[model samples]
Target: MMRSILQVPAEVLSELHATCKLTPYELKLIGELCEILEPFEEATDKCQGDQVVTASYVTACVQGLSHAIAHIRETYKSKFVVTKQSSLGKCLAKFEDMECFQMAATLDPRFKLNS
Candidate 1:
């Protein structure tokens, strides 16, 4: 997986990177590497070493960044918010937390799917 990422362009790298599961530290490292890669990403290679190997290394590094983004997003599950004002002032503060995304994802059989 690491080797596969290196020969691709940033967009391709991003696509490949979608699968990487990241921890927080990995994310920071990726950001740092990307900062280093920013100016040179589109620059012509002026290095004296093997071009193929260099390309591989760059791709792997970028892949790490992609992995981090995916990881963070997953770690922070997307939330759904539902809100309603309670009329307790008039009757009771009774309500349900049904609007939450996770809750909605598992809406009970009692819930009829809305189009």
Candidate 2:
């Protein structure tokens, strides 16, 4: 089921999140995803068979998804712009920010974020 959720076409999901109402199933899916997957998959892939959990793993996973979803949204932006924010936007933005922060923190101290 988790894989299925991940399989949801980034385009379709972005559209639904933007304009359509969220069915109970979609809402539950997102909630279950964060609870079950996001924290570990994105931030830390290498456990060394030692560390139980790391924010880095979760962040990495989320960042990957963000790019996919955001790309989908951007590609169809003019065709399907949401007038107001949706719950999914908030959630996706959370991942986006984490990705940004992770990138910022990793670079040399002199580097600055572009946006």
Candidate 3:
């Protein structure tokens, strides 16, 4: 939808500028969010695929997302500390509390004790 809107003639964008406009800060935030979520999205896709997905992947994916979120928070906290409770934070909050995922991953041979 955003792509289609952007592809529309400049005149149309100008006409709907009030509703469609995005400030530089907003665009930066959006990019940051996309970067932070990319790993989670890929993990979700892997889990959803027809191929067998070991339960071990759950812990790795969650850890990866946690790291990514932490990186984002650390990198941007100075500028956007107030948005710390954004979607990324919420996701971490929900999953980080679940300790069973780590055990499951550890039990799976694919992950083994190394995980």
Per-prediction TM-score, please?
0.22, 0.27, 0.51
Model 2 segments more than 4 A misplaced: 1-51, 72-86, 95-115
Q: Which candidate has the top score in TM-score?
A: 3
* Predicted candidate 2 versus true structure: per-residue lDDT over 6-57, tens digit per residue: 5676667767746575566876756554544443354335322354333434
Q: Estimate every model's Cα lDDT from 0 to 1.
A: 0.37, 0.49, 0.60
Best by lDDT: 3
Pairs that collide, model 1: 6-59, 88-92
Q: Which lDDT value does model 3 have at 42?
A: 83
- Candidate 3: worst-modelled 10 consecutive residues by lDDT: 1-10
Q: Who is ahead in lDDT, 2 or 3?
A: 3
- How would you encode candidate 3's per-residue C-alpha lDDT over 21-68 as one tens digit per residue? 865575566666665556667878755666675455765766676676
lDDT of 3 at 19: 52
Least accurate stretch of 10 residues (summed lDDT) in model 2?
Answer: 78-87
* Residue-level lDDT tens digits of model 1 in 54-81: 3323332333434443444444343310
